[model samples]
Target: MKRIMIVDDSSTIRKLINYILRKKDYLITEAEDGLDALEKLIETKVDLVIADLNMPNMDGIELVKSLRNNFYHIDTPIIMLTTTRDENLKKSALEAGVNLFLNKPIQPNLLLYKVESLLEGEKNE
Candidate 1:
């Protein structure tokens, strides 16, 4: 099974995502923010990351940049989960190497579809 790490400040959202992704048979891991996510990323092998933008100790954009600059996680898939729908932000994220983006108030089916598609693509690659 593919392993996904969810990095969010909200405990409620974390639980919701964990529940939904677990049902799909993906191994789920979580972090409270980008810093935590980085630590987790170093500690284990994660196939994908779903990160929130507005988080303490570090934010999603910074995290993406860090991942690119850091020796590890160069190819790890990142799916930005954010309330900000600004085209500029989306463009910047893509430039930073995010694999996908999911808006806030995420729909379960859509999340599943995006996750599956990215994972499937990775599998094909």
Candidate 2:
């Protein structure tokens, strides 16, 4: 089974994504912020990461940069979920190594589709 790490400050977002992916045979793990996500990642190998933009203790861009440096996860795909539509923020995240972006108040079907596609691509690689 494939595992996904969900990094978001909002409990609601974490729960919603966990719920959506559960039906698809994907293993779900969660963190409340980027710092917390790092600790979780140290203990588990996740196939992909679905992260959120704004969070306390570390925002998503910093998290992506951190993950990119860690040799074990250098190629892991990260899809950032954010409420911010600002182009600058998007550009920063892309530069920091975020693979995909999903705006918040996320649509469940779209989330599933993106997750499945990323997961499939990972398998191919």
Per-prediction TM-score to the true structure, in the order listed = 0.91, 0.96
lDDT for 19 (candidate 1): 93
lDDT of each: 0.87, 0.92
RMSD of each: 1.5, 0.9
Ten-residue stretch with the least lDDT total in model 1: 82-91
Model 1 spans > 4 angstroms off: 84-87
The sequence of per-residue lDDT tens digits that candidate 2 reaches over residues 3-116 is 999999999889999999998989999999999999999899999999998899999999999999999888998999977665689899999999999987899999999999
Show the lowest summed lDDT stretch of 10 residues, model 2: 82-91
Model 1, position 29, has a per-residue lDDT of 91
**lDDT score, residue 2, model 1?**
90
User: What would the per-residue lDDT of candidate 1 be over residues 7-124, giving only the tens digit for each residue?
Assistant: 9999999999999999899998999998998888778888889998778899888899999887768877789986665567777778888888888898999999999888888888
User: Residue 58, candidate 2: how far off, in angstroms?
Assistant: 0.7
